[model samples]
Target: MTATISGWSAIVSPRYLGATVTLCLGVALLAFNGFLVSTALPTAVAELGGVALLSWATTVFLVFAIMGGAGAALLKERLGARMALIAAASVFLLGSLIAAIAGSMPELLVGRALQGLGEGIVAAICYALIPELFPSSLVPKVFGAESVVWALAAFGGPVLSGGLTETLSWRAAFAVNLPIGAIFIALVLLIVPRGIRSKAEGRLPIVRLLLIGAAIMAVSVGGLLDSPVLTGLCLALAAATLWSVIVRDRTAATPLFPTHAFRLDDVVGAGLWVILLMPLAQAGSAVFLVYALQNIFAFGPTLAGMVGAVMAITWSIVAILVAGVSDATRPRLIRIGPMLLVAGLGLLAVALAMGQLPLVILSQVLIGASYGASWAYTSQTIMEAARPGERDRASALLPTIQSAGYGIGAAVAGLIANSAGIAAASTPEALTGVLVMTFALCAGLSLPAVWAALAMTRR
Candidate 1:
């Protein structure tokens, strides 16, 4: 049985408030960075001139984020939480500074890679720190606070980041991170004790990291190739390389994933598949959305950002609404999420073809609602289905796997859009046709997620 707590005062009290604020601030930094990049990249492209390499910016960051996350626990063990956080914040600050002063897309990507590494380590460490900083009873409250931070970021990020991009140079958006990072570090110093250090078990899979990196780069450049045969070969190579990672990791000395991973016949495996594939399909909106809104519809940065923000708002509200859903009914919600993703993506294609803004907004609602309705339940299924000893490892893999999906998905979207002439789409009609094809491919990617989600409903 769980311990009893009458109210949230135990968490909100002055004793713990600074620590609480630091945790929330960490979440804010990551959330704001994501929304800001999505909203401002179009502007950055206008100034920096890399429309062809647009998706590469995001793909690069996600790849490094995954890499950094893989090593977070090791950092904490070696450095302790206080020093670990300080170092992470410093890295993030350096990345932001580099990005602010960047003159070209390639240089900006270098900054983004560093930004990804810093943010990735910080995100993972924040989760690990929860148990260390709070009593078991208060841990739930800490997580609850984190969820609120995410919701607030979803609501405010577009507004804040969009305004920064419009009123100042796009550089100002990255500059905003500097102050936030400073505050996070200050509070971390004042609040967190020097955590105990221990020897970390196992080494990072350097070979696997390289393999995934190569695969992402392959997909990122695949669409840019002039010849159809070369493009096809590149994509095939990416798929095969990714498959090999999964295949080889199962038997590795230091396994990258749990033993049951990717086994469709196993429930946890099904849940993991759903996690990976969902973001893969959803990356289309993250990559192409602002450009389409700005170029085709002539939306200002703030307005275009708001259009994307609606999805996050819808997701937060829907997730809260469904939190109380009976266990008996939760599986049904899990089953519906990916199906809605497929439908929402399909609708985006239809909206682009029909040239309808209202339809686009409606599709966004469906996509957001799908995640809100299903993500928690799907995660619960995976955790519940895991072998007893694998629970913590299963939990750690979720975010990393989700990042894998987005990184790979962004690369694939690049391939598809470039193949459809996104690199040279100067006219509204040309851009529209390319987006239509891109979303259609996203919809197809979403179909496999439906099967994975369906597997979660089974025994």
Candidate 2:
């Protein structure tokens, strides 16, 4: 039954109901955990007394998650979707339990790494399975609904974690993951088909995996340290290692990213650039924006979270509504989307300079809505450009690139702020100056996205 997607209806249609929920849960779990942990980590650090190792929680999780994403195709081939998801959920459950009962920072870090592995694998699987399970016409709808899950988690994760930490204990936050994991396992077993598994080909790329991990670690560790010379050295080393890995992959018989992925003129390449740059631009200030809200605007945690969520909330609603756009309108929307992102960021920079909270919130909504309007189409473009056997690899590319951009962006942003004296400034005037500088720089990043979108149009 190839039903034309008129709206969100395609997702809720009888044939897709089970698959829809299953896919949504796979991603929602990842998103929820990310936000929840960020909110609850302060309390955990306070209790465990590992303030110095605080950044390691996020750094370890991200590095392992990227590793999981890179190896996802192999896992799927070896275990099949049903078993793969089950394994991921079980690992996630174990990690949650370990973290919940952890006595020290090291123990929690180990548990976080495990959770990252599971989360990354599940996220990659969600993308890979979409093409396999759904009709082409309905794929956008599935992506839209998945974005909604992400948006909901963005809002809900912080609130739930904050409430739990304040009212109960930070341990209670991790305990909640138990039920979600259980439900995810049940849904996968019942709804997802046990498809025939193919023979796993090739040994795991041990050397390439090591290179990727080293690069991420070097950059991450470098970013955390206050020494400029060390940060520069680490960041440079990370760049060289990343470059070598990409070059090696390109020449290999089985590459992680297809050859087209590296080309600027190709559809997949353009879409991939859009994916990378959007996050790069946003990450430059996304973390700072939260603090700015509380520090400069004097918003409470709940209120600041709501303002912070404006982008995601608008993203979900816009994505849902735009799922029904006509074919002709999609191209125009795609082109305009990056420009809207530019506008949104620009407005945000202006809002920060003027100290207007409402404008700040409005800018976030525009930025989020721009993503909602553009991402599905860009993602589709990437998949469409992939060779038949390469779609699984393509599925993993967007998220990997996006995550890398985020990590790198935040690191760069910190350097920018530190250099500008924002890191040491105590006055509200100094805080605003740093934000203005940071966001203005971030806003400029959208120009490359515009260029990428234009490149896609030429093709």
Q: State how far residue 169 of model 2 sits from its true place (Å).
A: 2.5
Which 10-residue window in model 2 sums to the lowest lDDT?
1-10
Cand. 2 Cα-lDDT: 0.82
User: Residue 310, candidate 2: how far off, in angstroms?
Assistant: 0.8
Tens-digit lDDT string for candidate 2 (73-111): 667766888898899888888888899999999999999
Candidate 1, run of 10 with poorest lDDT: 1-10
Clashes of 1: 0
* Regions of candidate 1 where Cα sits further than 4 Å from its true position: 1-22, 37-59, 73-86, 100-110, 127-155, 158-172, 186-202, 223-231, 294-301, 383-389, 418-434
State in Å the error of residue 425, model 2: 1.5
lDDT over C-alpha atoms for residue 130 of model 1: 60
Largest TM-score belongs to which candidate? Answer: 2
Q: What are the per-residue Cα lDDT tens digits for candidate 1 across 206-274?
A: 888788777766765664566556777887898999889989988886665667798888888989899
TM-score of each model, paired residue for residue: 0.80, 0.95
Model 1 lDDT on a 0 to 1 scale: 0.79
